[model samples]
Target chain A: MNIPPAYVLTLSGILFALGVIGVLIRRNAIVIFMSIELMLNSANLALIAFARTFAPAQEALRGHVFVFFVIAVAASEVAVGLALIVAIFRSKESIDVDEVSSLRG
Target chain B: MDWQDFLSVLPFIIVAGWATILLLVDLWIPANRKGITAGLAVLGLIAAIAAVISRFGIEREAFDGMIIVDGFSSFLQLLFLGVGLIAIAQAYDYLRRRDIERGEYYILLLYSLSGMLLMASAGDLIVVFLAVELLSIPLYVLAAFAIPQADSEESALKYFLLGAFASGFLVYGIALVYGSTGTTALSGMVAAIASAETTPVLLFIGSGMILVGLGFKVAAVPFHMWTPDVYQGAPTSVTSFMSVGAKAGGFAALLRIFISALPGAAVMWMPLTMWIAALTMAWGNIAAISQTNIKRMLAYSSIAHAGYIFMALPAAATPEVAPEAVRAALFYLVTYAITNLGAWGVVLAMEKAEGSGLTIEDYSGLGKKRPALALAMALFMLSLTGVPPTVGFMGKFYLFRAVIDANLIWLALVGVVTSLISAYYYLRVIVVMYMRDGEPEVRSEALLNSTIILTAFGTFFFGILPGLLIKMINQVGLLDLLR
Candidate 1:
């Protein structure tokens, strides 16, 4: 039994929307990080679904290839982002985005 | 993959290879004796510039169609290399003054410049995504380089979070675009779109998402919430470098993607840009007037400039106007880079010890104390306001001309009106400097001062004799490539 690519795409779209909403509402910097990860994962899923939808059987692998690159980039971003968060945490003693308001007008 | 690819990307190879080697070499250098790194980076930039010059007029697709060497990339590469050199010089003085001069900063800058150069030439969406990440990660690290400052760290965190979020959007957009077009290559996508009479809805949505991501990098209004805080909270040197470097990279990709790849969908993108450009100008100018902090003020002012650059996009849709549109863009970036970097150089000159002397009030009485420096600042402010006898005016003239030619006269009018609104704040800086009475003296660094004088000279000299640059832009065929 084969699953329709539309279902995968629909699921990915829902996940991406949820991720965007989470980012907008989340206050904690860590939670924001998680939200961004969710967004990236949804993009990965969408790419995979699209890859399968393309006519050529070999072309579908490009989506999987793109997914690998996304995961690698996401990991690196998280590494540097977490380190930056720690630096901020050391200085301000809080990871809440609200507390990081010293920069605003 | 071939000798042609190697020659095409010679400059990129030179910078990336030099930077990676330097990063390893930096580990052996004594921590306190780190000034050598900057000298090495300067040498690498000069070498990279030479490579770029050598590759001129040798336009071709290389690196498996992921990159191209053309008049467009050549023009932008020159600007990025120049920006990298000035940023390094500015950083040396800034870091020395703060007693935080380190090898890693220059290394990071070279890497970022490599990424920017890559963006200038990237012909594939995957390459664009990779180049953006390469450019941004270094910036995030550099923004927080002043680890001791709580503000710097906070700036990094905010920038990183937002940058990553933007990256997610970019990738998702690319994915959707690929899904619709069945290819991630820009040239392929364009061909695909051309073959289809009506653009698929997915392509339009994907392009919009992609624009949102690029808009954030260029700090366009509504997406620019990260800008002021990051500019203010980051160290001045990083802020100044990014103001030009990041903006240019974003515009480079934007120009290639929209103007080069999707000219077929003008009806879809142009109106959206009309709205974005108008709002950005309005918001950037209006908000700049009330800012007390000079960096934040310039940040808003930079946003206003982005809108101006963006105003040229609609004009780029037509084949006849595309070359003029591109020339206007290249000229605008060149002139703005010179003027903005000079303005920031003056800001750096006026910088005192950490966390003080950064407000607009710091410029009070600068005319009496340092007439030359104040004069330089005043010139930059004038140029930024699109006043005559400065390159800023010339840049705007060409941009507006291009817009009018595309029948975007209303957008041109908006540009003129907002430039009028912008003048009030830009002139206010001049007012505060010469008119206000305080003992504001510029701290003179030989390198920083020279950069300021050179940029200021270019601003005035180019404004008076812009035909020379116009000839160069024409020679680059910046306008001729679109048809």
Candidate 2:
């Protein structure tokens, strides 16, 4: 069954909304990072979905390639991000985003 | 890439190669002489500037249009490289005083600059995404370079999380634009947009998302929540570079993509750009007046400047005015860079180790303690306040003229009012410096002293005599902006 591109885009949009909500609602730094990853994955989903319906098979093929690059960049970001979390945890003795409040006015 | 295309991007290639080579060379250098790494980086940057100058008027694309070499990008190339050099000079003493003078600091800065150069030249959506990440990640590291400091680490954490979230929006926007137009390259997108009859829903949504992402990068009002915290938390040197370098990269992407690829859809994005510019100016200027911490105050001022620069964005909707608007924006960025860096140089000189002496109160009696530094600080404040006989005034003149020419009279008026409001806080720094009397404990650093004086003189030089820069701006404007 061929799913309409609009339906796929809608699903991606919903997932993106969930990720945004998670970012706003979650207090844990780790969870927030996970939410960011989720947002990126949702974008990846949209990219591939749109690629599927793109005319000219080769143009669609580029979309699939784009998803791979996105995943790779996301991985690098997570690696650095988790290391930063560890650094923050060591210094502050907590991973709670609320506790990381030394910078505010 | 063809040899000719490679020649177009030679300056970029040189800087990227310089950074990579420095990474290996940094290992062999004895730890105590980390200054050598900075020297090498500066030399490389100068060489790259020479390369950019040599390639003037040569325009071409490489890697099948993933990157384009053009006059506009060359102008920004020189700006980023110049900013990077001054930042290194400013950071030299501060890092040593704080015990964080790793050779890697210079290396990371060079790489960050290389990324910004690419952002100015990127011709495709994929290149934009890559360039943004490449530019951003090094900054994340540099912001937290003083890892022992909890505040530095926290700044890095906040910046990373928010930055990642923004990247998601940027990529999604790219995907949707691709979905609507069936192309990823901006040039191709432009062609597709011209062929299409009306602006599509998917493309409009895509452009809005893209604006959100760039907004966060440029620190426009709503997306600017991370700015003050990050600016205050990060080491002053890192904040210095990040403020000017990263913002330039973001604005470069915005100016090029919107003006080049999406001017046809101005009816969709121009109004949104207008509101963003207006709200950003009002919020940034209003919020800046209350900050006691100098870094946080500068952070707000930078946001206000972003709004002023963005005024040129809406003006870009008119093809007749886009070139002038962009030229004005470019001129403003250059002036702001010098004045802001000069102010930060004074701050860096005055700051005691472990982030002491950062409050505005710390400037009391600075005029008595370090008269030269105090005088430099006053000059920078005057420039920031847009006082006459300074580059800031000329920059604002050009910006307001373009906005008025485009019939954005209200926005231009908002800019004037905000500048008036901004004068109070900027002048307050001077008032405290000259009028108040308390012993200000300041560090003595020669490189930073020179930077402060150089930038101060530059602000004056460019202000009274803008003809030199105006001629260069006319030459370096986007080649096809009128097309």
For candidate 1, lDDT tens digit of each residue in B394-451? 9999999999999887889999999999999999899999899998756888899899
Candidate 1 stretches with Cα past 4 Å from truth are A55-62, B197-199, B477-483
Where is model 2 more than 4 Å wrong at Cα? B197-199
DockQ each: 0.72, 0.74
- Tell me which residue pairs clash in candidate 1: B323-B479
* Cα shift from native, residue B182, model 2 (Å): 1.3
Candidate 2 vs. true structure, TM-score: 0.98
Best by DockQ: 2
TM-scores, all candidates, are: 0.98, 0.98
lDDT per residue (tens digit) for residues B1-483 in model 2: 568777777777888899999999999999899999999999999999999889878777788888887888888999999999999999998999999999999988988898899998899888898889989988999999999788898899889989998998898888888888887888888888899932399899999999999999999978999999999999999999999999999999999888888987889999999999999999999999999999999999999999999999999898788889999999999998999999888889878886889999999998888888888888888888788889999999999999999998999999999999999999999899889999999887889988988998999899999989999888885654445
Question: Reference contacts recovered by each candidate, as fractions?
Answer: 0.61, 0.59
